[model samples]
Target: MLAITRSLPLRIPTRLFSTTPISLSGHSKWSTIKHDKAKNDAEKNKIANKFSNAIAVATKLGGSDPSHNVRLATAIENAQKNNVLKKVIEQAIKRGAGIGSEKKNVDTALYEGVGPGGVSFVVESLTDNKTRTIGLVRSAFTKAGGSLSPTLYQFDRRGLIVIEKGELTFDDIFEKVIEVGAEDLEEIEGEDFIEIITDPSDTGKIADELKKEFTIKEVGISYIPKEDMLVDISDEDTKIKYDKFIAALEEISDVTDYYSNLKNEE
Candidate 1:
């Protein structure tokens, strides 16, 4: 079913499946606490794994020297912000650079698909085994009522820099970024932050420049949807099913980051 909320379109599937129970009412304080904690745990793990993979790729591609390697430097900086422990970052570097006994082969991979509600998605990963990574990614898409495909036509590859607004005005950040190869600037309305977009290859360079002006929150290459679709999950049962589906997707370790065209209730 297709519906419109505000200016965005919502595509609902004809059939839905099993759902985990959840309370949407504000009255369920204890239930909300538990729910929030569980979500936090999921996000924490997801972020940690993503940085670990990024560190691996940076090391593998440009050696372990953060000073000399721009990608490694950015990866290290991003990891530290996510609270990835120093020891863990060092080990990931070692694993990628083959510097110690923990040496292992690792490489970045990506997969694209049409997820539930006709939303497109891209899955990024760093894996020692390509076959294993492919299998897990494909399985996630299938279980989400989606199918994996090679097409990424719905997305654009860009370097994204996330930074806090702090004391700087929008024009202040824009001026700095424009001089440093930024392609676009967007204020995340209502959120005290902004997103800077640049040529994928110029991300590291631009991020370094922005760091001098604002607190860098995140920097990386991503597949952003050219257009976004809002999925109406006003129905409690559908929201639960979607949440459970995403939780399952989050459980896959190799999936460093997954971009979706569907904007749904978290």
Candidate 2:
């Protein structure tokens, strides 16, 4: 159960919005993916739909209160960024929390499989109709020269928390985060945030501890690659094929996330 803090302020930095645990939605899966998913009108609509499901799911899992419910808070933030109407987000919360007659049977489904060139994929979806979602997702994979699998040994589901790069230096964050049991702290040079990776089970607890000081930009369960596949850019054919394949998968309305193990080094 989630409890919303009624009197505290927890506004996050604006630049911290991207990816997920990849969190909120599918904003920050990879820098390449982000660049591929430029926000046109169609992309914005896709984001809106994804966020609606995310908000509903977060509320159902935690509760409707954004303050106490980390997932819902993240969902709300990402949803607003995608131009999802405030009233719509509130309605989603209501439906998710079963607050009124406006109820929805939303559930999350994950498909682990391999995509083109043996790239591992963990497609996460929030759907009201699992049958339809599965068919479309599988079809997308099949068309992309891939097949569904029961397990994703190539991927490890982990807890990823992203905090904005505030006044605190890397050393400052490392000292504090390591004390609280973070597995690793990642600082990408020229990035606006530092990412902390934690054990999946301890995510909520550690996030709470960090919130005592840091403004959390995103937090959630993420399908991180056990080993990232290095894609050589000289192979333009492979890149083009994968890009088309990913676009097809993302076109499926229910497929809110497209997490892959392949990392095309820019």
Candidate 3:
């Protein structure tokens, strides 16, 4: 699945899965509370893990000083906005900075694979063990009847920045981003944010300029497919495999983000 940072105004054309539960009759009050709490805790842990990896990556990429590292500053800002604890943030920084015995080596890893229906994918993970991460990724693909292959050539690497719309109009952000040399600017209908695509080298410069007047929701390099491949989800077998593949990828904690060429068509 393509990971979209902000909500778009356009309605989604496809329903991957039904979120509504089929039955809730078997639950007691305490059981419900326990289930809810567990879900919430799991969500919180996922957020923490993502931010921790991001912070560590930013620090490793440009050192521990946020003042000198735009990516680090952005990562820290995003983490704080997500309510990640101060101590956790600091620990992540230390891990990246390689401070003391508590520090662990972390690296960014990428895996290229195919999903159900010949959908090409580029999966990114921030992990301490490449072997373990690759194993998990390969298993996901194999389970879905897909396989790892050379797929990076099917996409382009670009810097994608998502900015909150706030009180600004589409023209408002569009004009500003154009002035900053953004490659593309888009405001989808029904979305409350603007997306700006820029050259990898200009991401920090554009993001820094926008921060003075806009709320930056996300700033990172993303893989965009050269073309969209429509996958036939109407077939029961295809749909089942698609769901299975997506679930497997989601379960891998190290998999931070993924990009795919699969298109959901009406």
Best by lDDT: 3
For TM-score, the strongest prediction is 3
lDDT of 2 at 57: 73
Q: What is the lDDT of residue 247 in candidate 3?
A: 63
Q: Higher lDDT: candidate 2 or 3?
A: 3
Model 1: which ten-residue window has the lowest total lDDT? 3-12
| lDDT, each prediction | 0.69, 0.70, 0.76
Badly placed stretches (over 4 Å) of model 3 are: 1-32, 228-232, 264-266
Q: What TM-score should be assigned to candidate 1?
A: 0.74
Each prediction's RMSD to truth: 8.0, 11.3, 4.7
lDDT value, candidate 3, whole model: 0.76
TM-score list, all predictions: 0.74, 0.78, 0.82
lDDT of 1 by residue, 90-162 (tens): 8889988876866777777888876565556677777788999888778877887778875577667777777
Worst 10 residues of 3 by lDDT: 5-14
